[model samples]
Structures are given as C-alpha cells and as structure tokens.
Target: MSSVYILEPPTSGKVLLKTTVGDIDVELWAKETPKTCRNFIQLCLEGYYDNTIFHRVVKGFIAQGGDPNGDGTGGESIYGEPFKDEFHQRLRFTRRGLLAMANGGKDDNGSQFFFTLGATPELQDKHTIFGKITGDTIFNMLKLEDGLIRDERPIYPHKIIKTEVLNNPFADIQPRLRQVEVKEKKKKEKKPGVKNFKLLSFGEEAEEDEEESTRVNEKFVGKGKSTHDVLDDPKLSSKTEDVDEENDDVEEVNPEEQLESIRKKLKREHKKPVPTSTTTAEPIDTYESFLEEERREKKKKQFEEIQKEIQNVKKEYHKNKLKKKEEDIIATEKKVQEDKTIQEYKDEFDKYKNKKDALPKKGAGREQFTLNLLEKFKKKIQSMKDGEENEEDNEEEQAWLKHRLCFQDKNPVLAKDANRKDDDWFEIYDPRNALNKRRRGETVEKFKK
Candidate 1:
C-alpha cells in the first residue's frame, strides 16, 4: 500500500476553465504538488490561457492545450522558464480528467497541460499530476476529446475563453505573477508625397475645401520640380554665366610666395623631436625579443604537455578495454566448467571407475561391460569437447560479423553492397564473379558476360 498525499477531495482550491465547448471545474492538488498547482493558478490569474485552443486531443487518451502558440511548442511557466516536475506516489493519472503538465523530458515541465480522457497508467510517474476535473464538468473534457479529427486536432477551435480562480489556497502568499510588458504598437508615418494632400468634403463644405486645396497645391508646385529643370531656366542660366566671367578676372598668386608662407606656418605649428640615447633603445629592443622568445617556449611546453596527456588517456582506455575482454573470457570458461550436465558426467565417470577397480579379473563378460562403459564415457567426453569448440566458433563468427557491419557502416559503397538483395551465396563464392575476377588478375568486364 502507498501513502496518500491527498486524503479527501479538494473543495477550496479550484479553478473554473470556461472554454468554447463548455466549462471545466478542476480541483487543485495543493498539498501533493504545490509548485505545479501554484504555477497553474498564477497563469490563470494572469490570463495566459485565454483564447488558447486545445491543440491536441486523442480519443480515450488525452486532450492537451494551454499553449499560447496554439500549437504544442509555446507557453512558459509563471517562473518564465521550465519548472521541476512534482510527482507524488498517491497522485497519479489512474483515472480520466486528471490534469498533468506536458514536458519534453525529465524536470522539463512548462505551462502546457493535458486532460486524461481515460486511465493512463503509462503517464503516472512521467507527468506531474497537479489537478483533476471535479463534479459533472468532466463531460466537457470528454466533449473536447470527441470533437477531434484524424490528426488529433479539434474540427472547430475549442478555445479556453476565460479562466477564473474560484478558490485560492495560496491567496495569502501573494501570487508570483510574471511582469508582462505590453508592447506599444508603432504609429505608421505618412509618406512624404502624401503629406501635403488635403481631404475634400462634399456639398457647401467641398467648395470651401477646394479653395484650400488650390492654395496647398500652389505652395508645393516648385517643390515637385527636378534640380536639372530648375538649373536650365533662362534667369538662373544667365546668372551662372556672369559669375563664371567674374571668377576669370580675379588675379592669380605667385607659387614661390605661397609655398614660403605655408612653410613658415608649419614651422610655427610643429616642434622638433628630441634624439634618444642608442644604449637605451638597444636594451628595450633586446628585452622585447627576450620576452617574445620566452612566450614561444612556454606555448611549446604547453602543447607538448597536452599531447602527452592525450597519449596517456588513450593508453588507459585501451588497457581498460583489454582487461574487460579478458575478464569476460574467464567468466565464460568458468560457467562452462560449472554447468550441471558437466558435473553430472564427472560424477558418473568417477562411480564407474570405482566399480571397475573393485570387479574380479576372471569374468570376460564383466570386462566387456567395463569396456563398453568406457567407450560410452569417451564418446560423451568427445561430444562435450566438440560442443565447446562449436560455441567458440560461433562466438568468433559473431565477432567477425560485428566488425564487418561496423566497417560497412563507415563506407557507404560497402554498406550498399551488403544491403543488396540480388546477390546470392553462389555469386559471392563464384570465381567468375566481378569481385573474384578482379582479385584473380582477370578483367571484371569479361566475367560480367
């Protein structure tokens, strides 16, 4: 008998899930799976399950949903990441309507949940059972399951429209709700071409707006003209010609005078560099070279050490493998020697040897019987030896086959040849076969015919 974490049905801690199909009242197992219950309740209070559809549903199995992505890959816990699974011996998916967290692996529980449509013993210890459908609301879960198509998705979107917390056991503890930051939608900016356009109203208002539109169009008329057209205008073209002629009359300066003034200005702006002693410069260069050489030596030493470590590790691994093989061989030999049939044969041979030693040497019939018994013993011993040899041969064949498979796996061409169904045993053994012909210094094309 197992210890029961939940002795009675939970009355206070319950949640009302109003879905598109019908409402489902689930009682939380707060005592058994507190963290899982808390997470579910917090998500409900935050309205995370709202409008989320039951993405997966299977007849006589489960109805899974609560994924904000509407598929199965979204929704996080109240903690913002996957939480640890809370499994109780007593709290299991033994009956229908049990609520459990769906996870990818161990301790990977998220906000996605499932309702067991029937007894699911396989999922007992795997998923964390946090709640169970109470009262007649279990029929609603069945209704959702019934509405599923061949792909396990509902024909119509059976969405969880609202989630209301009817009773909160951890209400005094203050729910640890994740702070969801509402993203503000960016306002679209009007295009530059449409910015100056004004809306025209109808009737008497349209006449007044038309006058305003005329004024606006006139203001933007020059803005629409291209730069090339503006420059080609008669008034602008004449002004540009006058400016060019005026620039041609300006006096030119002597190149030698300009160069002299620039040199004087540069001399005032910059100062001369002071010369350093040769002795100081030489030591600095030598010291830098020495440091570089030391660094190179250190790197070389580290590389050598790493190579040695790798060799040592390889040697250790090989030694362990060889040791394990030797131990296995010894164990098999011991088992063969200690077999009941072999022990029985040994006992019978010992008894016969004692009887032969005690018998009188006069009777020919007694001697013939002893001879026949010895012959039978010899045959039995030979057969045992042959059996052991056969077993050894089988072991060798298995090992060779395993090695061949591994080799084929490494080479795709070999793998394809091994997988070919057309090749028969005779073809493999035949000297006229392509591979055999090639190996025996004959043309493969000649053998193909």
Candidate 2:
C-alpha cells in the first residue's frame, strides 16, 4: 500500500540461499513488504551476505544469521538506518520454515533474519515476516546437527557462500543491445550576394543543391526585384484631405533642398512678438473682505493651540498609565519573593521539629550532671574558706555561683498554685522531675559516699 517503489522479483519469485549445509530457496513476500524485499535483494546482489555465518542457532527454536559481525550483534540495512517491521495476518510464524526479521526492539528490523525450526507462534506480531522457505530440502536441512547451542551461537560454522537469483526480472535494462552514432557534414560557403539555407529533409536537400548549382553558373547580377516594383510610390499618396492639400504641389527633392526649406521655416517662427499696451490689476480692498481675512487668521491660530493641548493631554495619560503598570509589576514581584521566603522558613521549622523528636532524651543525664557539679562546688568553697585554695579556685567558685543564680527558680510554673503541688508525677511542678525519678538509683549511690 506504500507509494515507495519496489523491484519485482524474478519469474520464479524466489532466491536460492546457498549455505554450507545445503541450499534453501525462499519465496520473498514482495507485495506485503515492498521496501523490505527491495532492501534485502539489493544487499544480496552486492554480495554483502557472502562469507557471513549463522551466528545464532537453537535446537528446537529458530536459527538466525545475516549478521556481518557473525556474533549475533551487528547488522544493518541498505539505507544505513533500520527499517520498520511489516507484519501481516497471512504471514504468521505458526509453522516451520517461516523466515522473519531479527530485531532488537519494536520497528527495528535490520538485516538479520531467522528461520523457524518448528511452529513458533510466540514470535508472531513481534518481527517482520518477509519470506518463507519453499522446498522440502530446506526443511530437511533445518534439522541438521547444529552442535551445542550455547549463548545462541552455532558450535559448527554454517557460512553463506553466496546468494543467487535464478532469473532476475530487472537483469536486462534494454530488451536488446546495440550502439548508434551520427556524423554531421561540413556546410558549403555562400557567395557575395547570395544567402545560405538549411537542409531540413531529404527533399529539401535536393532542392537546395539545385539552387546552389544555378547560382554558381550565373554571371554577375544586381539585387533581385521585390513586390514594390508593381505598386505605386508610398510618398506620392495621402489618406486624409489635409495631407492631400499639403502635398498638392510637392515634388521629389534632394537632401540640400529639404535642408534649406526647414531652415527658412524655423527662422520665421523664432522671431519675438511685439509687446502690447496693458496695465497691472490691483487687489480690491473692502471692510467686509478685511474682516474676513482677520477672522481666518484668528481661526488658524486657535486650531494650532487646540492641537498642542491635545498632544500634551495624550502624553500625560500615557506617562501615568506606564507608571501604574510598572508599580503593579514591582509590587507583584515583591509579594512573590516574600511568599517564597515564608515557605523556606516553614520548611526549616518542620525539619528541626522532626530531628528533635527523633533524638534520645538527655533529661536524666543532665540531672545527674547537675548534682555532681553541686557537690564539687561545695567542696571547693569550703577549701577556699580554710585558706587552702589558690586564686584559680576562687574564680571557679564565682563561676559556680553565677551558674546557680542563673538557673535558680527558672523552672516552668503550673496552672495551680505551688501550695497544691504534691510529690506525684502529675502534681510535680518541676519539668525535670521525670529525669530525676529515672536517675533515683544513681542519686542514692552518689549520696551514700
């Protein structure tokens, strides 16, 4: 159905694929796959498949070949590009000897093809089936021992010596063979007063020869006569009455007489005419006319002023409109920037909250740490009061006092008064009470020493 041109197969409509094992004749589906058939035949005639091996072979499946690499990896079409798969309902791989294209994926059928060892319905609609093995010899050859079919490679090489076309339809360009040549004769020279003529046909050539011979035999002669010899002179006649009167006494004249007549007429017309008696006319002035002129000037001035006022108004309106549009654009951009910033901040807050919830609670660790610091601080202060500590010890005591004062009574308060508080998990006023309770064992050990 495609408009692409295809080469008609030979009268046999089959190609003989001679292999190492045997020769298998295949009937190419020219009508169904015009482009694919044309490409395959061209490659065959060019000897591209010569010396190529059947790289892929399966015991009970299919045998693939036509790969130039001979490793089941490389092959290409005539166009240097892949061709689309052509599948038809009548060309199903439902039986053995079915020849179909080998492709990497959809519509990527290249030069590689396969022959089904048996019924391979699983391959239907996935590859382009372009031909089919025709004879019983090919079917028998397909059953030959292909050795171990590991990695889909034939252990024994089955090389394709060459493909042969029994009777190619386009073999002879011309029905017959012949050669042709044409030799042009040189033209004869013409005499002084005679014109040369071309010989168009056999009859014209004979007539031209006779005319040439007659002229050669004749002696010197003047130019031949024309039809004007029998007609009256054109200058002696006139088509109109005025023309006839102008030429009533006219006679044939020489070049000198014509020149003299033209000169005399030109001199007579070139003389300047005499000036006539005339007076200059003055513009009539009246009161109504003067008032009209004044009113016209006044209206012209007012029209110019009105034009200027309109221009100014239009300019002001255009400037204001442009300014408003710019302001609106700037405001919209600022609003968008603010929204982006707010979104970033919210994202950061969510990340921090998730991280905090995932971490192990350090409340009990902090309570034990604080109790150790208090014990150390009390010992250092008592040593300093006994004059057994240095200046550094005094400084350390001051830092401890600062820490204690900063943390004093800083715990969160409850909704009820402290007087209502009790030593229970719910009634405890301190936020760290849970940490201390968990570390009660450690606290008792420390106080015992």
Candidate 3:
C-alpha cells in the first residue's frame, strides 16, 4: 500500500494585482500542476482572485484569468477535483511575463490562467503548461506591440494593492520593450530632369549677324557715367580712399565751382500765353485713310453674312442626319425583338437551373396534405356560409373545421361563432366560393337564356 502526493501550491502568497490597467504578478505552478497549482493558489488566497476579469481577450493571444462570473465559463474555486496532465517538455512558452494554465476540455484544469501576450508556439501542445509571471511590476511595462498594454485590458484590471512571498526572490529578469519606436526617417527624392536634344552643326554653328553687334551698340554708354553720375563718379568710389583721406584733411570743393552751383538750382516759373485745345488720338492721315476704306467694306459684308450662315448650318446638318438615320434603323429592329424575347427567357432559366437536382421537394406530408386540402375547401365554403348567413345549422360546425387542419400555416381552424354571428360573414357582399356562386349562376342563367 503506497501512494503519497502532498501537492501544495494553493497560493503560498504573492499575488500583487493593483491595476487601473497594469500590475499583476502570479507565481503558482507549485511544482507543475499540483492540482492546477493548488487551484490557482486557492483562488488567490480566498479573496477569490479579487475583481477577477481578463475575460477572453485575444489580441496577440492569451490574457485570460481566474473567472468570477465575468463570463468565460465563470468560476470562483470549485476544485471538486480533476488535474494531472502537466505536459512541460522543457517549459518555455517563450517570453513576455509568462503564466499559463486554463482548460476545460481535457481533465478540465482548474482556476483558469493566462498572461503571455507574446511568444506562443501555436500554444505548444495545446495548453496546460502552467505558471510563469516570475516578476511583475507590470513586468517592466510589458510592451510587445500589436498587443498594446497600458490600459487596453487583457490581464489589465489588476490593482491588488500589495502581495509578498520569497524563497524564489525576483531574479527572473528577461523582459524588455522599453519604448523603442524611433520612426521618421524618410527623405530622398529628386530625380526629374532629362531634356537633352543638342545637335548643332550648320558648319559647326556660330552665325549671330547684326553686323557683329554694331560695335557693341556704339560702345553703349548711358549711365556709364551720366545722370549726375553718383556725385561725379570717380569710378563709382567705394569711398575712394576714404575720400582721399577726407580730402587730405579738408577743403577742395570747386570743380568749376561744381557747375556754377548746379546751374543756379535749375530755376522755374509759369508762362501761359494763349492756345489750349487738347484732345488727341491722332491717326487722321486723310481722315484715318478714309476710315480704312470704310473698314474694308464693312468687313466684306460680314464675310458674306458668315458665308450664308455656313450654308444654313450645312443644310440643317443634312436634315438632322437623315432624321437620325431613320431613328437608328427603327431602334435596331426593336433591339432585335427585345434580344429575341430576352434569349427566350434566358433559355427557360437555364432549363430551370439544370433541372435543379430534379425538383419535387414538397413533402413532409406535404404540409399535412395542404392542410387537409385547405380544411376540406374551407368546410365546403363555411357550411355554405352558415346556410346563407345565419340561417344557422352549419352542418355540424362545418365538420369541426375539417379536423382543425394547419400543417405549417396551411391554416384552417377558425370556425367563427361568437353567438350565432353572421354579419354577412364579414362581407363585401359575401358568396366567396362555390366557384363564386357558380360563376354568378352561369352568368345569370346565360342572361335568362
């Protein structure tokens, strides 16, 4: 007789959660699956994993958590038993603040679990590889993108205020993603310029002839030193040796007494004597060449009236192009007889969709045989409408509405009877059957024969 298994992981403490959306810290695989790590540390040490949540989220995958009725098949801690398959294989569901376990299909592991959000080799051999969130001060901000963390829920709702445990000390380091993003580095474009055509060879080109530029336009000289040449330019002085050292210290002012002091300040005054008629757009060389020969005879009579209005618009555009080509050949023979009657009704709807797998699907007792042939033709026209409207005795309530028929709405059992009622059987002048009153009594007995 021998079978000892003191499994102990019911949460030896250390569950820190405290989260508006971050901190967590699980660490309970108590020697691999010890009864699902002691039923998830005895349901987070009795407080049943506080505000439990992490529902099902699956962005990068895995964030689940101990349920507390937040759906995901809720749970508080019903270890009523079941757990043995640990399946480790050198444990390593890869990185990013690990933590595992969560099952229901096989030996239903307890106290659900999750948290990885990173490397998940196709969920290794299909789940149940228990515990790993070795360290969790938000595992140094758990960033692995495409799985956002900060506040976007997952294992996010944590806020356990505090937790503590030892003997494993926090040396599990292995986390990273400290922000990285960099990005903006894109400028390298400038390629459009390819116009090349230069062929010149008219005897090796070079012929610009205006008599060799007329001696450089007679040695061009206007402002080459005129218009008061910036105070008699000395070669436009850049302060000509500081004005010859301030004129070697003073006074050297008269160049012909500076042109008789610039012609006595160019004097002026008014001298009107008489004549003053002004208006002048003068081109009257012989009355403006006789009004340019009467404006070339009124522009040759408006170019013969615009060539008779362009031959009456080319004879009304060939009489409306032969009346629109006889109305487009009578609308193309009525669109080829409406495309041969729409291709003979699309070849009879492609022979009823290729005999739609041989029709005849009407049966399941053909709706109770069409509701017992429409309630025996509506109780033979409602007992001839209650024997001509309330002249009662409707043949035993029309045989009980023909056995109350109604297989899938082929409806029938409404044999009206609120106290011998019969307002012309809800009529617009009733007589709704018997083939419409025997075709109106054979059209009034064929008009009274």
Top TM-score prediction, candidate number: 1
Clashing pairs for model 2 are: none
lDDT of 1 at 128: 91
lDDT values for all models: 0.79, 0.73, 0.59
**Clashes per candidate, residues 3 or more apart or on different chains:** 0, 0, 9
> Any residue pairs clashing in model 1, and if so which?
none
Write model 1 residue lDDT over 1-449, tens digit each, in one string.
12332553454489999997789999988988888988899888888899999889888999899899998989888776888988776676667888899999998988999999988888867899888888899887788866437688777768899999998888654555558799999999987763322353345676667677677678668576444443446544322334544446667899999999999988977766667766643455778899999999999999999999999999999999999999999999889877867898888789779967978677897789789879865764575555532343344235535421111235445334655666563333786677786788876565578
- By lDDT, highest first, what's the ranking? 1, 2, 3
Indicate the residue-level lDDT of 97 in model 2: 78
Give candidate 3's error at residue 424 in angstroms. 98
How much is the lDDT of residue 258 in candidate 2?
Answer: 91
**TM-score of each model, paired residue for residue:** 0.40, 0.35, 0.19
Candidate 1 shows a clash count of 0
- The candidate that wins on lDDT is 1
lDDT of model 3 at position 444: 46
Clashing residue pairs in candidate 3 are 10-41, 11-41, 17-159, 17-160, 18-158, 18-159, 18-160, 19-158, 19-159
**Model with the higher lDDT, candidate 1 or 2:** 1
Off by over 4 Å in 2: 1-12, 167-449
On the 0 to 100 scale, the lDDT of residue 233 in model 3 is: 55
The residue-by-residue lDDT of candidate 3 on 194-215, one tens digit each, is 5332344542223343334454
